[model samples]
Target: MSSREAINVISILGSDYSIKAPVGEEQTLLNATRMLNATLADTKRKYPTLIGDKLLVLAALNLCSQQLEMKQRHQEELDRYQEQVNATVDVISRTIGKN
Candidate 1:
């Protein structure tokens, strides 16, 4: 809705959607649509009888689950990095105190 936003059309689950995205985020929108479609395809293969809203819901759930797992993994990695930095700072402090 902002002045810098543009309408971009993306296809997912064999349907096209027109979304207003920030000018610089066209690729991100396209990428998200691609990811969703891929998830939808997988869900459809697993539940061939599902259609319409039910199929979309299942695919969205799968995507959400994957996103949560990735967020957890990313947080773990950040914690590990913080610990390493803290340890290095502690060592430096101790060495400086001895001087």
Candidate 2:
């Protein structure tokens, strides 16, 4: 591995995790670590018996749900923008055709 591809050590869920990423990926890594910790904590609180693969699965589901919600909201915004654009184009086309 190149020197620039050096792995960075980060703490997540009270465990040390070393991840290799781009130079500016520190913040992204931190954010992911934080999310994981939050998911683990929340799961542990809600289900005290959660352990092993079950914890990982629960965390993955929680993260996936968050991602899906964000994606849906983004798609809604894009659809609204497309509608506005189509309306503007329709008006412009009509105006040109009349002239």
Candidate 3:
């Protein structure tokens, strides 16, 4: 590993994982582990009998669903902004043509 990279040990669902991250991004890696653990905990709470691989799979699915939802919302927002920009540009073009 280069001097700009560091190894960090992050715990997720009580398991410590050694991960290599860019020097300044160690905290980001830790934060990601924390998010995973939090999700696992929440999944466990909702399904008390879920254990081992099954619980992890459910948590993974939940996270993926959340990601997809966020991406859809983001795309919707971007489309709305693009439509507004297009309208503004058309208005500007019309105003310039009238001059």
TM-score of each: 0.91, 0.84, 0.94
lDDT of each: 0.92, 0.85, 0.92
Across 1-99, the per-residue lDDT of candidate 2 in tens digits comes to 676676878875566878897777778887887888888889889898988678879988988999999999999999999999999999999999999
Give residue 73's error in model 1 in angstroms: 0.8
Better candidate number, 2 or 3, judged by TM-score: 3
**Candidate 1 TM-score, C-alpha based:** 0.91
Residue 33 accuracy (lDDT) in model 3: 81
- What's the number of clashes in each of the models? 0, 0, 0
Q: Distance (Å) between predicted and true CA of 84, model 1?
A: 0.8
Candidate 1's residue-wise lDDT over 1-99, tens digit each? 888999998877667888999989989988988888888888999999999999999999999999999999999999999999999999999999999
lDDT of 3 by residue, 5-98 (tens): 9999887666778889999998888887878899999999999999988999999999999999999999999999999999999999999999
Please tell me which model should have the higher TM-score, number 1 or number 2: 1
Over 4 Å off in model 3, which ranges? none
